[model samples]
Target: MKKIILSLLVLVLAASCQEQQKIAFVDNGQVIEDYQMKIDMEAKFKKQDEAYKRKTDSIGQAYQLDAQQTQLKLSSLSQKKQQEGSQQFSQKWQLIQQQLQYEQQQMEQAFSKEMDSVIKSVNKFVEGYGEKNGYTFILGKNAAGSVMFGKEEKDISEAVTKAINDDYNGKDSKEDATETTEKEEDK
Candidate 1:
């Protein structure tokens, strides 16, 4: 029984000595914010929003003009006729409002879907980065607080952000090639 216990202890010691787990965590919010794709997408969405506003404003101005002209025409009519005309204009305005609302909703949905895709791509990139670097684990720290506390040295958010931005800008492969060239020159 003693010998068996010694053997178990030896096995545990050997396993412990084999390798240390390499863990790191990234501030997901910072990484996403620095990602070039996200920045570009945000700019694109902003422009789209502005364009929508301009178009709507133009439509609104046209509607206002029509309403003014309509009121002028109705002023010459009888009271009953004026009431019916007012109702018709009100219905037309309601339709315009609904149309504007629907367009805005559609724009919002498209922006949301695009952003979700961006997030998925970023996740995939991080997974690949971890695997390529032989990391045992790469955790994320986000608004939800997946990681409550980690050593500052273990916080690799900056590195991850740089790597991701490099990848986004298509510089990762180029940098890898440059490193290989430098290695050959050293040899």
Candidate 2:
């Protein structure tokens, strides 16, 4: 009917005239870089890497000592026996080298896996933050240019970074909200 069509048009117009969505953006790189968890993880991995280096160095020293003794024994060996001893020593060295390479790769893989977890946590936190704060849309601006341009005022990257760090430090979001409200009231 004409009346039904008119009513639908009126409703649509009213909805369209309502306030726009609450949208904002964050710098993806900055948020991840400034996150305390990532920093802590990096430090942890660095310490582990240094310890690994020390351990490998010790293993090499021990191997060199043993190799020297083997060399001395080989020197007193018959020519044919010396050649066999050298071949066996060479094969052992190759095995050691392979083991070291494999261990190094494993450590690298572990590091990568941990970093991936950190990144996922950050993204999940950001999603929860946007939902809890009544955001209609929250864009992430990364190097790939997902967001071409955004107003500086709408860039909530710093607040988000601080919030995430506070969360990492075991500080609640409610406390942060209360503090922000109090600051605004004082102002």
Which candidate leads the pack in lDDT? 2
- Residue 119 of model 2: what lDDT? 91
The number of the candidate with the highest TM-score is 1
Model 2, 127-161: lDDT tens digits are 98878776788899999999999987788787778
C-alpha TM-score for every candidate: 0.86, 0.80
> Candidate 1: global Cα-lDDT?
0.84
> Compared to the true structure, candidate 1 yields what TM-score?
0.86
lDDT, model 2: 0.86
lDDT of 1 by residue, 1-187 (tens): 9999999999999998997776778898988898889999999999999999999999989999999999999999999999999999999989989999999999999999999988998899889877776678889998898999988777767767777778888885446534533442343
Worst 10 residues of 2 by lDDT: 178-187
Quote the lDDT for 107 in model 2: 86
| Stretches of candidate 2 exceeding 4 Å from the true structure | 1-16, 175-187
